[model samples]
Structures are given as C-alpha cells and as structure tokens.
Target: MRRAPRRRGPLSTVVGIVLLALMLFPVYWMVNASLQPTGNTLRGGWFPLRPDLGGYATALRDQGRNLVTSLVVALGSVLLSLALAAPAAYALARFRLRGTDLVLLGILITQTVPGIVVANALYGAYADLGLLNSCLGLILADSTAGVPFAIVLLHTSMRSIPGEIVEAAQLDGAGRLRVLRSVVLPLSRNALITAAVFTFLFTWGDLLFALTLTTTGTVRPVTLGVYQYIGAHTNQWNAVMATTVLAAVPAAVLLVVAQRFVTTAATDGALR
Candidate 1:
C-alpha cells in the first residue's frame, strides 16, 4: 500500500513560502535592476515601470564572445572529466583491489584542497607546456574540479549495481571494457548526468583559473568577462546586471532540465 504524502500546516506553509521568497528576492531584484535605465541603478524604482532593453543590448554586444568561450570550455571540461573519471570509477567500484579505502580517502581529500592551490601549481606547468590562455588549458584546469568528484560519485553509484548482474555479463563472455560500456554505463545513467551537470556548472562559472592562467585578451571565460565588465562599466549598473543575468541563464536552464535526473541519482544509490 502507498503512503499518502505528508501535509504541511498553515504555519509550515507560510514559513516555507517566506523562506523561498527570501532566497528569490535577489534574483527578482536583479531582473528589476536590469530593466532600469542605463544610469545609476541605485536611483531605480523597486519595480521597473519603464523597462529598458538597452542594458541587454549593450551586454550582448560586449560579452557575447566571452559567453561562447565559457560554453566551449564548460563542454570540453565535461567531456574530458567524464572520459577520465568513468573508467577509473568503474575499476575502483567493481574490482576489490588492495588499499582501496586509502585511495578513496585520498580522492576525498582533493575536494578539501583550495582551488587556488591547484591553479598556482598548474601555472608553471601550463606555461612550460604552452597551454596557458588556451581553451585546452582552461578545459584541463577545470577538469581538475570535475574528475575527482565524478569518480567518487560514480564509484558509489556503480557499487550499487548487483554483483550477480556483473558476473552474469562476464559469464556471457563479455570483457571488462564491454561490460562497462554495455551494462554499467547504461545502469548508471542518472549518476552520469548528475556528474556532467555539476562539472558543467563548475567550469561555466570558473573565475580563478581564467584570471590566473590567462594574461592576454585572446581568450576569456564569461566569469572573467563579467569581472572585467564590472571594472569597466561601474557607472552602467543595468548593463552589468544584464550581463550577470545572461551569465546565469545557462546554469538555470540546465538545472531545470536536469532536476529529475539529479533527484533520481541521489535516491537511486540509497535505495539500491
């Protein structure tokens, strides 16, 4: 028998709505600011009585190229991280190797290390390898954020797959690679999507790597572009806010589209 969903009391409902409103007020205010005249946003009204598109026009004109660069770098990071992470996760999950717990602990530790430390270490290596300021360099740097996290998440998900199922595949004369490709990946689809979504989000918003690794205007992510935009257009708050809104769109859209998978990926492991 199915359990009925829990119902909230009036007070609980009111509290939930108030909390949601508090969280969303800034986003509402950003849109309100973006629609104001291109002058001082501080003088703008609480609501935009005269909405202006000029801010959006100016933002796209200035930062469109940088937006594309961010998209490219984000997609590249997702692909590289997944390619490297998936196999490693599969091996660590299925194979009962020696000292596996220590290795997993080490991977977990990387998450605690500050991103600045990694960027500083990669700086000299990037310079020597001629990767600085290049899309490839940014992709590689961003993948550092993605790979370890992906491995840990994917490992947990893959481990939940039944051993009998994996052994059955092997019994059918399937090799390790084949089982991973045909069976494991198909079963772990939700976890894979969750990993990719997070990786893309992290790479899309990365600023530290963009600032540290690149010196010239030849390449820049939207995050760096926005930082520079703020420096250059301090007086034009509407344009600045417009650029921020644009920067936030991809992330918002991605989250809405992938909400189901992320929810499923979390529950799937626990239930298994």
Candidate 2:
C-alpha cells in the first residue's frame, strides 16, 4: 500500500517565510543603496541600473578614522570583557561562595538599569579623569556594560561542564588555577568565543556613549561616522549606506567564523 503524503502547516510556513523576508529585506536594501550612484541616491532613485564604487571609495577615504576607531574599540572591549568575566564566571560556576546567588542576581539587575542613566554619572567621572575622549576610555566603558551579560552567559556554559571533570583534575594534583586552565577552559572555549563576539558587537554598534564620550574623529566609532553623512541642508545617502555596509562587514565576518561556537554555547545552556 502507498503511504499518504505529509503536509506542512500553512500558518507555520507563512510565518517562517515572512520572518525570513523581514530579516533579508534590510540587508537587500543596504546592498542596493551601497551600489547606487551619489547623484542618483540624492534624487531618490529606487534602483541602480548603472552602479558605481565611488561611494565606497569616498567612505573609505573620508571615514577611515571611524572604521579604525570601531575596530580598536571592539577588539579592546572583547579582550577586556573576557579577561574579567572568565574568572568571575568560573568562580560562580565551579565554587560555592556565600551569597553567590545574590551576587549573580545583582549582576542581572544591573543590566536592567538604562545605559543613559549610567552614562550621566559616568560621563562626569570620565571627564574628571580626562578619559572622556580616549579610545581606551571608551573600551573600558563599553566593557563594563558587556561584563554582566558575558558573566551570565559564560557561567551558564561553565556550569554545563561535568563536576566530575573538575574533581578528576583536583584528584590529579592540579591546583585550582591549573584545573581552570587545563580542563575548564578547553571545554568552555565555545562559550568564551560567544562572549567575545557579543562584546565586540555591542562595542562596535554603540553610538550614544561614543558620541557623548568622544570629541574627536580619532575616537569616533563607525556608528558616529555614519552621522557625518547627514547635513542640515543635504544628506549624503549613498555615502551613508556605503559606510554602513562597510561597518557591518567585520561583524558579519565574526558571526560567520564564530557561529558554531555561539550555537553550541546557547544550546548547551538551554539544555542545562
């Protein structure tokens, strides 16, 4: 006897396609605009029959400082966040401390406070210390915002490591630091990559803090660089789109490279 054919749900299929289109549309538009000529874009042309690379050239030459600033800040934020968060996450995951739960809860609660609220006080403090217009200062500020989330995510990943593995390391005459380096780190590499990627993306995309803290082009990130395309009388739409596309390339590359790590870390956390 022949078996009946299986069928997909109409609502589910429609919803999935809609979601896909919604995600893809912005990417499509960005690419389209990036290829458009400056004059054509300014005139509100919809499509580019004769695409040009002039906008990209202009963005690279004119906005190079912004690109460099973003790269430096992102790299710094990732390193700083991981350096501090890895140890804190390890301690929270592997050791039992008094008020551990309360500490974790406090970390989570800090995320609830708006960035703007913290920025107000932090701005004054940074100004006093002469850290307001520095790349290192921005990195420090961005890393602070990222550390709590990284700690929570890394803690979840670390907890997924079997307690027996840690105990076995201890039995093998390994010290806490050795166990962490040899056993915990190897197993938690995926989580570490995930944390770094998130931290990089957050620092790279930040504009409010960058704008408030940085006074010069040398420290202005790509998000602020895109703002330069806007003028009182005339906006450079082609350059804006081109610069935006360029800005997103680093994040896109990072995501592609670290996607497996992100997936594994998230799934492991969910199952646990």
**Model 2 / residue 49 / CA error / Å:** 2.4
Maximum-lDDT candidate: 1
For residues 129-207, what per-residue lDDT tens digits would candidate 1 score against the true structure?
9999999999999999999999999999999899999999999999999999999999999999999999999999899
Could you tally the backbone clashes for each prediction? 0, 0
Error of 1 at 41 (Å): 0.8
The number of the candidate with the highest TM-score is: 1
Q: Each model's TM-score, in the order given?
A: 0.96, 0.91
For model 2, residues 166-267, the per-residue Cα lDDT tens digits are: 999899999999998899988989889888999999998998788888877656888887775565213456777888899989999999999998998888
Candidate 2 CA-lDDT value? 0.85
